[model samples]
Target: MGSLALKDLTEKCTTKYKKISVTKDIILLKNYCHEIANKSLQILEVNLNNVESFKNISEATLALTILINRKRVGDVQYLKLNNYTLPQAVNEEHIILTESERALSKNFKRVVTIGKGSKAVPILIFSGCDKLKIF
Candidate 1:
């Protein structure tokens, strides 16, 4: 009887899993992140219209952290940040920076203020998918 009960439970779980779709899961996750991003922006005194911006930043930061923690050397990742600048709080200690690249024609240099001090470090900032590559 115990074996029969276990089999029935397994079947129910399988059916429930089959009903779940990847697209739906992704949408749910994006919505959840949007909510959190909005709250974070409010705390930072950022405009409400920039909720999506914050979400993308959070996602990219997570991706970078995962790649660095995994020690995946030589793996290059790209992030797109159209016009959004890196927050003044981000520094080399926050995210591991290997290198950065840009054409000579560009006016803005990728740099971020570090810590409580006034010093700045070169940083490649990316938002959605415009022109930021991470190595």
Candidate 2:
């Protein structure tokens, strides 16, 4: 068997996603998902001791994780309680992170779980998400 080079096909090989306005569509999808996620969170927060509320919040959190991170649904569907925790990446003050960036970093909690291909997928959650209490 012999291999042939077809440089002429490179332009045609571009995926549709690369050629179209994927950003606009994806951003709109995420925006809609965010609204539902936020609503579910609010309901859960207000009914802290309700069992049904807990389930709704858990579902919302999972949906948010999958959407926000753009991971394969299978990747995070198996996460356990232990997977959630404070940020594992050390923030070095000397690295020159902007004040705004640093402030934003404080709100994210890091969760690494083994996903497809046995790779660790990091899921970042808002710090206050610890209140899920669904364990």
Candidate 3:
């Protein structure tokens, strides 16, 4: 009896709920947010700081991080400071990386955090971020 109900629920979700994506709209949003983020950073540098400007930059950062990494909100939001700022881990001798991979490795750093079911999840952050090179 319980299995029947579960099956019905799954079937309804599969048939009735359709996933849709608007690529054009998403691109527009990303572009707008990117501009706002850059503007906010410039304002902050000029010491024209305000709560509103800070909020806008923070929101933009969160949106870009999620979009770029295709990560869940929960996974990113709950990330600890230590986990995110940890030194980049180099692949051990057992791991083999292609030439392009080696070049890319110089650009980005990985941060690992615990996710659902205590699984390890990795997020990539550009290495220059610590040097204030967010853009």
lDDT of 2 at 125: 68
Question: Model 1 reaches what TM-score against the true structure?
Answer: 0.26
- The CA root-mean-square deviation of candidate 1, after full C-alpha superposition on the true structure, stands at 13.3
Selected candidate, larger lDDT, 1 vs 3: 3
lDDT of 2 by residue, 1-135 (tens): 223345445545764345564788877865665566567667767776767655666776676677667788787788776665333656465257788877887786667889988998877766545455543
Q: Which of candidates 2 and 3 is the stronger one according to TM-score?
A: 3
Q: How many residue pairs clash in each candidate?
A: 5, 0, 0
TM-score of each: 0.26, 0.55, 0.72
Candidate 2, lDDT over the whole model: 0.66
Model 1 spans with C-alpha error above 4 angstroms: 1-21, 46-135
Off by over 4 Å in 2: 1-51, 86-96
Which pairs clash (backbone N, Cα, C closer than 3 Å) in model 2?
none
The lDDT of each candidate is 0.44, 0.66, 0.71
Order the numbered candidates by lDDT, best leading.
3, 2, 1
The regions of model 3 sitting more than 4 angstroms off are 1-17, 93-95, 127-135
For model 3, residues 1-135, the per-residue Cα lDDT tens digits are 699999998889888866666898779878987788778777878876577777777677667667767889877667788786566555683158778887887776677888888888887765433334433
Model 1: number of backbone collisions: 5
